[model samples]
Target chain A: MATKSVKTAQRYAMVIDAKKCINCKACVVACKAENQVPLGVFRNWIDEETSGEYPHLRMSFDPEQCHHCADPSCVRVCPTGASWQREDGIVLVNEDDCIGCKYCIIACPYDARYHNPETHTVGKCTFCSHRVDRGELPACVETCPSKVRVFGDLNDPKSQLHQLLATRRYEVKNPQTGNGPQLYYLL
Target chain B: MREPVWEFLIVNYLFLGGLSAGLYFASALATWIQEDGRSAYPRIARWGALLAPWPVSLGSALLVLDLGKPMRFWKIFFHFRWRSPMSIGSWLLVAFTFLSLAYLWSWLEQDERQSLQARIPGKIRKRIPARVQRWLDLDASLWRRNLAMLGFPIAVGVGIYTGVLLGAVQARPFWNTNLVAQMFLFSALSSGTAALVVARLMDREPVELKEMRFLYSMDITLIVLELFIVLPYLIHGELSSLAVKEALAQVLGGPFTIVFWLFFMGIGLLLPLAIELYEFKPVILGKGTFHIQPRWALTAGGLVLFGGYMLRYIFVFAGQATGFR
Candidate 1:
């Protein structure tokens, strides 16, 4: 949709193809190792959904994390303004201002946020902004065994993410939330 | 099987916040009525004013304690965001507490000749300097009226904010209805009135029969009103999308069904409502003389308080039990 006449910041997005996922959970482990997420809580996870019965059964391993929506419910519900969004649409929590009331945990439709017992603040997936800032991929995107995840700027017409959106049929989780979530699941 | 972000502390805070709002509203009503030359319910104004602050103070403390970083609770006060219910609620609570305290002070500052002065210790009364005593004894009728008028909407806001705090969470379908706020407001009013009735009847002072009857009738109306709003709240949830329907099933026929039907609906609401209707029926029908029986009044009032708490408990836990999944 871009004419390339106006400059805009990179709008980061993720597209996952669950059909290729083997559910080895390497991405989950890598996310934890990179983010140091507290034990018993996760910044990213793999959920398994099975369908049919008997010999016709099929299962899908869906890896999930914060969508970092265009309009995030967690940001709207935060009382202290600790939860905020970047110009590039990456939602992050400022630990210094978070009182840890946990309202955002309840507000998240995807159950993405967790109370990090170690840091005593709400923690969630940030798309590994630290790595992205350094011209590197997120730990999860880099670690997936089957190449299940594609991460790039949706605003860049030349990027693989933009190309996928232009050519593929995909669905987003909980579209009813009206948060305009950026995570796309290729159908 | 995700953990709930809130627990018992939040339930208590919701209940107490609503109760304090209801109490303050009821007291403001009493203050306005007393201005009409009715002398029976002066004690209601005093009792409600005095008791309103305690529950809210304790509730706010519990809310802060429930936080992950309790010491950083003060950060909520640095700025206010109108779009955030928690931010609005925090400011509402602080404003209500101060108004409640000021409202209490107005009652206490009434002319020293009143019976309230007799309760003060003789030594403490004597120790006060003449100038301070004169100032303390000034007739604060105007201040009382103005404060009551100003505080009425604030109290209502506090009552509604408790429900809106949960209702604002779109992710939790169980609490995503506007009816929750309306139901909570009426429930708060009923519980506040019940509290005043219980305190007045249990005290050593002689209960004003007229005031007692007024409170009974009011509670009955409020209880019935609460029932109307609560049913709609349930029906609205059940009739929404599948996620909302499933979330509401937690109370409809799910694990919370027992407490929802038995404690809150039966004992908490219907039973107390039946008692008040029975007690007030005689007075309304004009068939025979009736007296305010302390025993029955206490029973009804206590049940209402219990029911109010149960409403918050069920909604809090059940709402958290389900989400967009």
Candidate 2:
């Protein structure tokens, strides 16, 4: 009998374009509405990085999500089988099963997970699985005025995300973590 | 200025875990090495063997309380995942609890026998109830030792696992280091010995001052070792990576600097080290009678234990100060 979690066959991934991002935060609002995310907690958001002196400041927005890494740190630290990677490669948490020890939250280097005080469980970006299953874009992607967020299967070469990756250069969050993070940011 | 997810419960839990593990190991070792000798160590061993299980049990209880969904805490036991550090840690806690309880029970029964033997008149000793005689005949301390034989590694496992819990998180660059386990294990040993010293002094038992001094010296060495392992996270973090360097800077010169350096490094490490050093010295200036006032020993032990708790808080908070952007 296999004692481990079932494995995934598909690897869902995300890519963002910093250059095209306008910092409108529509995606953040859309994610909150789609997930009914509790106040003070988030499933997805935009992080702004600012560099250069005050007189010559340059700021850029990078939309962040769960990353759904090939090797997820949160999945490895969850005490119960509360957190798991689906066969389609979307990393998710089972709120009912979660003991809410916060180990997964601490394990997530991206700080993507947050404890939902209302449910007394940890919550994170689910990649709008409900919408994706219905052959629709995620709420965040659908609502984005700039359409900076791209989500799809890396294995499907014809997908928009795959096509974008093939044509553009990008960087994943914390490459040194060696978790094979799937969130890629295009310059 | 976000608050850390972990709070006093975790800090308190880790310290209690270390204390119980250290106490159990020290007692088991003393029992193994003990001969027909007049020493205060036997008293230390007795106290340890008797008191080892409670703190660990209490700490585990505190952990359960700290959980977001305390009711689903049982889910940790129903499913097992080798890939999960928490899965392994929960199992270790269960194992440690069982073994430590057994060790405690053995000693309790031994105390019963000693009391029974002392109360019975020699002429009536043989006439004692057969079941009572049978109970008294069993060697409880020896039974505890056999339990210890299995419990020692498990105890050490619990101690190191606490550190590994944080260290294994690769996303938290400040915590993702091999050094945490070394510092934690050494602190466990030192704090455990200090607890023993405090217990012995408080009891006012007949003991060699030399043994007390030796424990202080040992604690000072462990303190120095812990400092060497921990201070580098602040010193060398800037050279690691931009993300990691920022996280380190938050603790070194950022808002957390005061608590990190003042409370943790200052009061926690250096203060305890200074106290232990003074205790390590001879009663007189150079070579004189060894002395340790119970009050002084208690103060040093309390400071070391406090320092141990501070280390955990720093790890949890500083690790979260910065994240991938």
Candidate 3:
């Protein structure tokens, strides 16, 4: 029942440039490679939205991942604490303890979680916890061609993500969900 | 928005929970009123109590099998997070099954006291250890009392928890209503009572009509209750999101129209109600054998059970037909 909030750690966050993303799906490919994500399941994905019929057609490619919300529903709904949070704000799934009940999958409002067919457990973007612990960037950030992705410690004032969040006009997805999503999109 | 994470097994599990819960509750009620010495309906109490625990244990087994890592399902017991309904349900189900078994054993053993124990030789009965007699005495003393104290709430919990399991999902708006728990409980009771009636009819040796005014009227009331909770939950459903509206439409007149209207509403709910209503106050014919028909009563009970299952099936499947998009 105790929380890990007592630890002094950097909270990681991501900011993506929607205008720069070409829907190339390079981030998706990189994520799968790094995580060994199964087919028909995704830790992160791109959602394409368009409106208007003819001349005024507007379109955007929205690259989405787990928000690692301040109040994560997946963590709360997980019966065995399989879905949990680190002090640094990254949400992680402990595959060993997961019962594959899909409670977390239903709880996630953003559809960020996926049931891993191979592991027989629910999984989501871990914010590349392995690489983060090794002082390396996530595979999506490392592999992005146009430098459209920025991932860093939000608590570190010097990090690009911190400066971008302060300087640029950005918005989080599904603000109405009230999870306080950490991932931001630069408008 | 995607393939449903819960499938038919989950539906079956829900049905079993409701059915078992209803039977236990009905058995308890039958025992409570049997003091008035109603011979026609005492069989319901006896068979219902005897049959309650098996389906519950079987349903729990299905739930474990549904979890792909069936071995890992043990984690649910070791890890009990209060916020998670599934976590609480794991333990609740175990408690329910154990207590229901005790209840069944105690009630069935009472019948043995007269028949089996009386046949035991006085010398042998005397030679039996005091400890053995005490254990046998528990059915009448401890378990029968425990059935009243613990059995009722545990049964209700099993009935409502199925609804809570799905209703807890905030992403699935169609099932997220507070009314879901009430609706499921009512359906469980209606179906459960029908199961009791069917079981009672099965034991009857006489082909002639029997006086079961209590069972028929009780079933009719329960059928009315099923409609009472279900109608508003279906009709004035709150459209919290566009996805919910799409999901609710499936039940109204969409992809699941025939199942919802024809099978569930018409045959399951309405027809059962109508048949039972006719049998509740049938017109007396020549010899009066044509008047109070046991077959009509049997049909009504069976139909109510069918409706109960269809209700669970539609709620789970249609709830997913439109999901978070």
Who wins the DockQ comparison?
1
> Fraction of native contacts in model 1?
0.92
- lDDT string, candidate 1, B121-177, tens digits: 999989989997886677765677688889999999999999999999998888887
Model 2 TM-score is 0.87
lDDT of 1 by residue, A1-187 (tens): 8777768789999999988999999999999999988799999998999999989999989989999899999999999999999999999999999999999999999999999989889999999999999999999999998999999999999999899989999999999988899999999
Instruction: Give the candidates in order of lDDT, highest first.
Output: 1, 3, 2
Q: Among these predicted structures, which one has the highest lDDT?
A: 1
Model 3 misplaced regions, further than 4 Å: A1-9, A54-56, B34-41, B110-146, B205-211, B238-243, B282-291
Q: Candidate 1 has which clashing residue pairs, if any?
A: none
* The 10-residue segment with the lowest total lDDT in model 3 chain B: B283-292
CA shift of B189, model 2, Å: 1.9
The residue ranges of model 1 lying beyond 4 angstroms of the native Cα positions read A1-6, B35-40, B109-141
| Cα lDDT of model 2 by residue, B38-89, tens digit | 3235666677777788888999999999999888888999999888877998
Q: What's the residue-level lDDT of B85 in candidate 1?
A: 97
DockQ of each: 0.81, 0.65, 0.64
What lDDT tens digits, residue by residue, belong to model 2 across residues A78-161? 888789988777889998898889988887877889999899899999888888889888898888888788888888878899
Off by over 4 Å in 2: A1-9, A50-57, B37-40, B109-139, B210-214, B231-239, B282-286
Minimum summed lDDT over a 10-residue window in model 2 chain A is located at: A5-14
Candidate 3 residues B1-325, lDDT tens each?
Answer: 6777888988999999889888888877766664444424456676778888988888999999888688998898898899998998888899989888777777765666557677889999999899987776555533464475678888899888988888887767788878898888888877888887787778745433442555666777877877887777766674446656666888777778899898899999999899877665553222333355668778888888898899889888887656556
